[model samples]
Target chain A: MNLKVENVSYRLGKKVLLDNVSLSLQERERVAIIGPNGSGKSTLLRLICGLNKPTQGEVLLAGRCVHRYPRRRLAQSLAFVQQKANTEDIVRAEEAVSLGRTPWIKPFEAWSEYHQGFVEKALLQVDMQDKRHQYWHTLSGGEQQRLHIARALAQNTPFIVMDEPTNHLDIKQQLGVLSLIHHIERTMLVAVHDLNHAMRFDRVIVLKDGGVVAQGAPETLITEALIKEVFEVESRVIKSMGFASNVQLIA
Target chain B: MLVKGLQGVMKSHPLLFVLVSTLTLSVFIVLGVAIGETQIDFQTVVYAVANGALGTQYPINAIDQGVVWNYRLTRTLVAACCGSALAITGLVLQSLLRNALADPYLLGISAGASTGAVLVTIAGIGAGALSMSFGALIGAILAFMFVVALAALASGRRMGNISTQVILAGIAGSQLFNALTAFVIAKSANAEQARGIMFWLLGNLSGARWQEVAMAVPVLLFGLMIVLWHSRALDAFLFGSDAAASIGIAVKRVQVVLIFSTAMMTAVMVSMVGAIGFVGLVIPHAARFLFGSSHLVLVPACAVIGAVFLIVCDIGSRTVIPGQVLPIGVVTALIGAPCFALVLIRGQRK
Candidate 1:
């Protein structure tokens, strides 16, 4: 699925959060939004996911206005995995993942076989097949994030939006989550804080004060001058093995 | 593997356990009619109930018939219905709000009913025996609507943040209603009227009648069906709003429907039998502990356990003092408080 943000802007009370931000993601594109704190990175993702409406412009998914689509229909096309992990009840991981099939279920009907298959496949994708029976409260932070990702995957949507997907993860789990995203066939738009992690994306979008400052292939846009201007840091971008771009912050 | 394990556990206890429990409760319900100050014999009670229902050729005294058939039997059935209704309402609300502490009374139904009953008493508006129950019903429904409206306003018509606000509003509403009730009772010139008001406030099934049962049974059944139909949505809500909404569940609509229906049931039950406490609050937790949190098991189990608990409490109320018929509400609190404390302690240990 292709996502097009056409001149989107948002304001909260007296503060303008996003200003004329327009971008697009083609099919199977892995894109990262990188910026300093309060640069509207998370807000941009929320707008794209239709959780918050833009003040001035609109978001289009496959050439249809997202706001005009029914909520269930929109949900069927795009899934969002939020940053929060605290749940009020003790639910099994499988039960949580099965919720991804809500758009396909009718009132008073049992879950169908296709929904079950999707949940199973999604769990297996995250390597959480063994933990399907475990309580969500018993899992580690990284495991819970992975479980949430699996739930998003189970939605069977071609597009996935994540906000700060690596917030509380350690270095190894961080790499694991990014690697899983890299291997998935779906189009992904992730808001990330780490430049090195953002370097692994097919495209990088640098934002400043809610406007798109630069966007293109990661190697072309993640320059030392861009880092100093957008992130207030002196950095070097190096070419590494496995077609990976590595970043080292200069002191 | 876990599914098979759960199935095995359920199979081991099938309908046989429910049948045994139901049989024991029926015996207790029948035995409850035999007690009371009249000292009616077991045979007389049985003959009275059968003759009352079937017009059998059994010789039964008029006074015994009035006490057993007209009074004790109706009260017992009302107690059972009220208990079942409140427990089911609590289960639905708890699941809807995703809060274990959510109960029918916690949403201001009891307070509203109490306020309505007190207003009717003070104004002498149709001060007949049945008017008090009617007034309570109106008050409960009004209070329920007020709390819902307040919660909706606070949450921007969203269901996720309404639970805590609804509870707080209920507390405020209860206090306001209690103060009004107290003011009315203070101004009463007749000491007998004061005593009647006190008894009603404390809650009793002593004045139970066939008319009350006629009103309660249908509401209970309707409420049961509504809760059961929304059971899957309730399960989704337990995972949280985003999770539920992500799954295509309309969380707000389900919350509104469940709250209003449960409140309607609560109002009718409270008006008929006064404000019986603790059954709604405690029975769902007990049901969850016995059967897991799955609504398929928890909801029906809550109804059964709630009915049995109140029946046993009603029996205790009659037999414990011999001559004096204790208020069923007081008995339930006395019995339920200690058990609730035990559960709390156990939960902490866990």
Candidate 2:
């Protein structure tokens, strides 16, 4: 496993944010975490990404305990993309993207041509080539989302973790971002609100009340009964759409 | 647009702009020395610098040397150092705290320093600049520690001080310290002593000497070097704390380093010359308007511009009325507040 979370638990004061969650990822594998709000998907991702410490167990990256790895080394191995990357800074789009090269650059050193290449290629991949010089705050919400993903892409880490990578994107841009993520050759652990996006993943982890309710290949774990049991909502899994099937949810 | 033009020039030759600005400040120093209460000639000022007192190019007087070197030169250098120190502190603090309004004084250092100064003067514990600066440094450290601890708690013990809690804590801390200083002065001092304490509270650069400059310059250089060394980590902080951490920055360590350096600089500066407002508050924003938020460019720009601003304000304070000195703190707020407003308006329009 390129990345492993073994029996991790987290408590925010008295609230058990996550309870004994375990998962593993192979090289270049894509896994989606699907759950309703307050189900610990984001918290689990946060723990795995080293943003928060787990109360129990540990996260291992590249066969080393994550806590033991130096911060820059950990950042070089994994990149995190958020749904919204908010900043008080009034900076150009290209400058914001260049921040991804920070782990590679040393203190007081300028970003090299090699670093700029990564940023340029990522922007091009996101189709934000023309908006490179534009102010980040002025960009549309969808554009901003793409730019942030591009920032993660620029990091060129082997493991990528995202929380709602498709939020704020239009339909075309949504698919575009997914296709972009899909085409990238990396291990992806994504928390996705859209079940359609999750179904396309190689595997899915279903979360409920801060516990792992089910985990399997999406086709097996994503049955209507499980959805009904967890979300308390009726859902129908229609066939013929492959893993990208329409999982219709009714109120 | 004026700033845009300057930025365009800066984009191509940032070194040249910084050098030229430094050169401009050097000329301002000479002018500041030359055009004091006595209004000596530029030629004589140059002669005093180049040829010394005994055997000059043109018969220079002892009074001229005394006024130029003993008074103006020392104050000018202090102003330059103060400006650079406060401006760079503001730049680093704003980035570290992720607050646009963060400045050297925002952490309660200035208020605490004032309290220390008042205590010393009223109780007659220590006289002279050295002991006064020592007292102020002690007071500043106390306030800085308290505010930082409060901010850290408010941020849920997170390593970074970027939370709104730090700012709120600082505001409270400043009010408490400022009130304590005021109460000490009002209650303890006789009329003459109170007047003197009041003058110091309004900010003062009078009686500036080479010793004060000697004390401030090394710390100023040290602070600048440390900030320059941590420029990349500081850039990481431009994004919120979580993002900075995700990128592998030791955010807690960086925040502690930044807090210490800025507080140290502010303590030294405020102790030497009272808490001159607005340089730390507004200069970084003005520098940002010219150069984007990249600290590599922004920090240098702030240093140069901030020096020029304080020196210019110093000149105004010197010449505003015939021999009646005005507190520099007054002029900086009077000027810096409007400049900051203009920057906000222009930014919004852009």
Candidate 3:
């Protein structure tokens, strides 16, 4: 499903978080949203996932107003993986993943074979099949984040809006997560902090002060001038080994 | 291989364990009917129950049948229902609030019921017409409404931002109702009224009646249905508000419905059988330990185990000493406090 945000604005009390921002995503697109701290990247993703209503203007999913869609219907199209890794201590990994099927199952019906297959696939996709029986609190930070991603995958939605999927991962785990996202065929809107990983995405949307500053193909949009303008950093983007981009500070 | 082993354990043990526990509970219920202050023999009690329920051609006296089935059996059922309802309510509230300490009475239901029971005892109003259970029901509903209103006021007329505010409102309302109960008790006109009020406050199932059971069962069943219907939503809540909303749960609406339904069920149960404590506070955690944290299993497990626990406690209260029945609440607290302490200790070790 394609998502279109038109002139969307949001305010928290008196402060504006997102201001009249507009963006669009084509089907099966992998778009990275990158911004400096407190630049409303997470807020924008929340708005897209229907967790927060826009203060003004509209978000359309395939030409219909996003709010008009029933909550389950919207959830069936898009799932959200949050930045917070830990849930309650009692939740098992498999039970946590099974929650993704909640929007589809009616009350009192036993989980069907299709739901089981989806959970199995999700656990396999995140490579957490071995840890499926572990308590949520017992998992390591990166493993918990992967489990969160698995939960989103178990929803079997075509699109996923992720808020910092690699927030606390070590270098190796971060690459593993980014590589997993890159290899997946579904549309993903991810808020990422690392420019190198963002560069590998099909598209990047740069935000400054709650509004879109620049958006285009990663190669064209992520220039030295834009980095200095938006991020206040002096940086170099180098084409590195294995077709992956590497970013470094020049100063 | 490990997964298969775990699955085998779950399949082989938990269901059989719950089944055995349920059977033991039914036996306790039957035993409870037989061993009371009246000193009826086992065969006579069985004959009485059969005569009362099935109208069998048994040579049972009318008075014994009435005492066994109409009075003792009804009280037992009411106690079981109240225990099950409160435990299930605790399960739902803990899951909803994401707090281990939340219970059925967390919304000021008990204090409200206490206040109403106290008021009736002090004023001597409706002494001939209204039962203490009715007074408790009124008090519980009022207290529940007051808390809801306080929450609404704190949240500026919206149920948003309810995570901490509802609990705070409940605490404030509890204090308010407790003070009111104390004041009413202090100004009572007679010593007998004070004793009655005190007994009600301490919690008892001595006066349970068929009429009370008739009122309590449907409310308890309704509350159970509400919790079961929203078990998935409760699971979503454990992920916190944003993730829950992202998954298409109407968090605020579900919270309101759950709280109101739980409070209503609690009021009915408390009215029917004074203010039994600790069953709600400890049984859900007990259920969690036995059957993982899935609400699908947790809710029913808590209900069943809670019923059995209370039935056994009531049996101990009645039969532990010959001819003297202890307050049901005291027995539960005696049992639950140590269990709660153990859970906390274990949690700290973890």
The candidates, ranked best first by TM-score, are 2, 3, 1
Sorted by DockQ (best first), the order is 2, 3, 1
User: Model 1: residues >4 Å from true position, as ranges?
Assistant: A47-56, A61-71, A111-115, B1-49, B52-66, B123-130, B156-160, B187-192, B348-350
Against the true structure, candidate 3 reaches a TM-score of 0.93
Q: What tens digits encode model 1's per-residue C-alpha lDDT throughout B221-323?
A: 8988888787766766655666566555655677778888888988988987788888998998777655655565567677777887887788888788877
Candidate 3 residue-wise lDDT, A19-112, digit = tens: 9999999888999999999999988997888777899988999888878888878888889999884555466788888888877877767667
Indicate the residue-level lDDT of B122 in model 1: 68
Q: For this target, which candidate reaches the highest DockQ against the unseen true structure?
A: 2
Per-prediction TM-score: 0.87, 0.95, 0.93
Instruction: Report the C-alpha displacement of residue B205, candidate 3, in angstroms.
Output: 0.5
DockQ each candidate and list the results: 0.40, 0.80, 0.61
- Candidate 1, residue A160: how far the Cα is off, in Å: 2.7
lDDT of 1 by residue, A1-251 (tens): 68999999998766899999999999999999999999999888877877667888999999998878776788899988887645655457887787777676655565567778999999999999999988778888888888889888998999998888888999999989888888788999999889988988999999999899999988878888999999888888888778767889999
lDDT per residue (tens digit) for residues B1-350 in model 2: 55447666765676797688878988888777777777788877877766543555666787887777778888998999999999999998899878887888999999999888877778666655447667777788888888877777777834434468878989989999999898888788899988877777767999589899898889999999898888788888767878888888877778788878878888889988888988998999988887777787778788888988999888888888887888999989888888889999988866
- Scored by lDDT, model 3 comes in at 0.82
